[model samples]
Target: MNLKESEPTASASLSRRKFIAGTGLLLAGATLKLQANPLVSGAPLSTLFAEPIIDIHQHTDYMGRTTDQLIAHQRAMGITKTILLPSGRPVNSASTHFGVGNGLQAKATGNTICYGLAKKYPKEFLFGANEVPDVPEAIEEIERYLKLGACVIGESKFGVECDSPEMQKIYELAQAYNVPVLMHWQYGMYNYGLERFHKMLEKYPKVNFIGHSQTWWANIDKNHLDQKVLYPKTKVTPGGLTDQLLSNYENIYGDFGAGSGLGSMTRDEDHARIFIEKHQDKLLFGSDCTDITGHIDNCLGAKIIAEVRKLSPTKKIERKILYHNAKKLFRL
Candidate 1:
């Protein structure tokens, strides 16, 4: 027997490697398809997913994720375009409040990384500029990114009063840049003072204000008791503060992202449908999840998509919330 006949050639070995790699990707994709079926039901979350989504809010280096993982996560969700919102420069000294948990901190995830990623993956990404609102140079830094073509102005998830002078400056920048501002409105934590936030909304009428987080969502219940309650499971009272803001203020919009966003929608299905139809034009779909696979026992973003689909009265309304609203607001 000739050894050459028995031994695998270099081309054969290369072919085998390619085949194995392809198989792994196929397996992963198949698993995702199965998981997505329950959420999307009729179809899987492929690049051709029904919504043609544009994720208005996402982060780079989120929760210690690698760059490839970050891209993979967005691609897995079938997001048509994504806006990467970087954190402002972290303070050198400790402050009264730095937010809860690892993901909530005001770290210095700068505009450079976001710019680089957006530049490198223009088809997949666009970025937003942000800076620590209280800092003296905050407006200057934010302006720099805005001039550099940041499509949006936040993830303003800092430990400052929502209507503070510092936050006002950021909102002013939004007006100047002619871009929307996405605020993370937690009650006692980040972006404090939801009740007074109306003042800023009034002050910055020309600027589109996108609200996210627990406090903003929880306000959908008129009988909401605690300011710090992240998720309110009570029956929605038809016309809550959130409803009013979305109704009365033309500039105000909702970001259906993260646990808070999903909680607000799913907390009451009946109300969610009404809210979905009524405010279809004012809502934007954003997956603020840090999950790389975009599939889990409970991926907040996927669940929100499902909820919106389930609750939206018409296909047009569902499309508006899922992507059209974000596209028009962000000018993507």
Candidate 2:
């Protein structure tokens, strides 16, 4: 009698409680399997902690998902707070990539939507302002949002160098407002000339720069080849710029979100452990995940959380990466 082979009748409506219970069972089974054949030397998820998470990197309009759904998903993940970043005016290249015209308009709409959500759920949600750095009036636009209580400045996906004159101006604004600037650093996509990004770091000593995406994570390995910064490689070699920057720069931070964040951990568990422990102060937990399910088992965010717990030498460090670091950085 294979119960798995049975089909439900049209009238067999599954209750939400039953669906949640089934999902939990499935996740428990998966956890057991991983524990049996651990991916690393020890089981990373052996001791699961249900600490509150602060997701610093999320969008309001990912895949047309609504604010209601996004909030619900965050609640499901035990995320106590989330910062919503709005995309700035798209560069021509970005516009083509996303199949949208007028990046500024898109950003404005996102800001409005996110602001509304934050107003509606003041404790659970916060919003950021965004503008293409190269555009005229960019500073004015950012100032407007800053005045309106925007906590961060970005998701700055532009087709310009990180140290471009326009970006410098925005950095100045961030310094004035004492707000952190979040950047998506994909080599060819956004923030071109990442190797030279250190110049901006030096120039704006007061502004906190939170890095995200493949290029930033790949550089975690010192021996990461220039050609492979956008690609994920298994096995890591120490001496990457990320470690050096975090060690040296007080204003720079890492956003552990998306495939890039998880890849950095799973690629080399040993190095990851050391890296997290070494730079726990500057590292933050984020979920650039777009899935509606909000289940960590199926999300890269969950994998990163598990890996952080496994690698962290102490429960205190795990809590910092999951919540405290973001809380301190954002002044939450």
Candidate 3:
């Protein structure tokens, strides 16, 4: 074959490679429609069959960016939908509770812009209202979102244990609404462990709890740790915490989002290979891309997803973590 004729066969070979390397869990009956040019400036596209993503966690400025920009960015990244939470400062090491007044100050007018986004882009964006237990009228505020069709509650930032009486009440409300509650779990600030989260799991039984941040997914060893070097380093080993939690609790799941989630997957590629293989069904893909103006381009969530996809040679496992697990969890 001459060079010109050989080019056609070579191009076809490359396209086949692209499709073969793409995300396998291509939704129910969805097929990949490859663009003529799958290469975006030398970086390969995830795959032509990349499953549509439903980001379970994302944040935006209350009075910040235009929804158009948010929607466009999400679409560009293959995110078909996302759950939006109000941005709150991390207080102490525990959860940053947001009351009605607090939400207002944070510029998250409960029924303002976010509500509009949900109404306008019902398919691509979901609104999750934040409720701080310390506020007496928190329940009422929660009802407002429920009435408006908010499916989940919180990106609850806490520095305390999940079993606190205040947290119990939040779980109760979640059960009442029949929705899952999302919590940010990290080691440093005010950290809590699997035992604490498990306590709540035991108490509520009915409330579905989804955990995020590094502390939640670090898979730390519950047996022992040198407390001195725990902070940042996090005394736990990979596949430790998640393995136990998924095995013990039926309703609990972890969000692979933010620095912690990305850190866990990248810190040790070998461990990640084993961890994802075992707990693939228990992990949900999310990116803590809450702030609109910061770190959007720099966020490596897409890369992390691609990296995790490579851990296993087969696409079955990747499909589970990328979308199926989350789809079944969120009932989307």
lDDT of 1 by residue, 1-332 (tens): 99999999999999999999999999999987766752344243443565588888888887787888877677666676888988777565222254342234623256899999999977778999987777778899889988989988887877777777877877887888899999888776677777877888887889999999888889988888787678878788877788889999999999988888888877788889888888889999988887777764556666777778888999999889888888888876
lDDT of 1: 0.80
Writing each residue's lDDT as its tens digit, candidate 2 over 1-332 gives 77755766544546656788999999999877656532222322223324668889888767666666676667656677789887765455452245343333232245677778898878678989887676676888888888899999987876677887888888999999989999888776677887888878898998999998889999988777774457676688877888778888899999988888988888888888888889989999888877666776776666777778888989999999999999998898
Query: Per-residue lDDT tens digits of candidate 3, residues 1-332?
Result: 58877566777999987776664545322333334223222112344325676678766654454565566456555676788875332222224432333442344434345667787767667888665554566677776787788778876765556677766777888898888988876565433554466777888888888877655655543532433333243333543655687778888887887777777666667767877787777888886653442233554566556666778546887777877887887788
TM-score of each: 0.82, 0.80, 0.72
lDDT of each: 0.80, 0.78, 0.64
Superposed on all Cα atoms, the candidates' RMSDs to the truth, in angstroms, are 7.9, 10.8, 10.2
**Residue pairs clashing, model 2:** 89-103, 89-104, 90-103, 222-239, 222-240
> Rank by TM-score, descending?
1, 2, 3
lDDT of 2: 0.78
Q: List candidate 2 stretches off by more than 4 Å.
A: 1-50, 90-109
Worst 10 residues of 1 by lDDT: 93-102
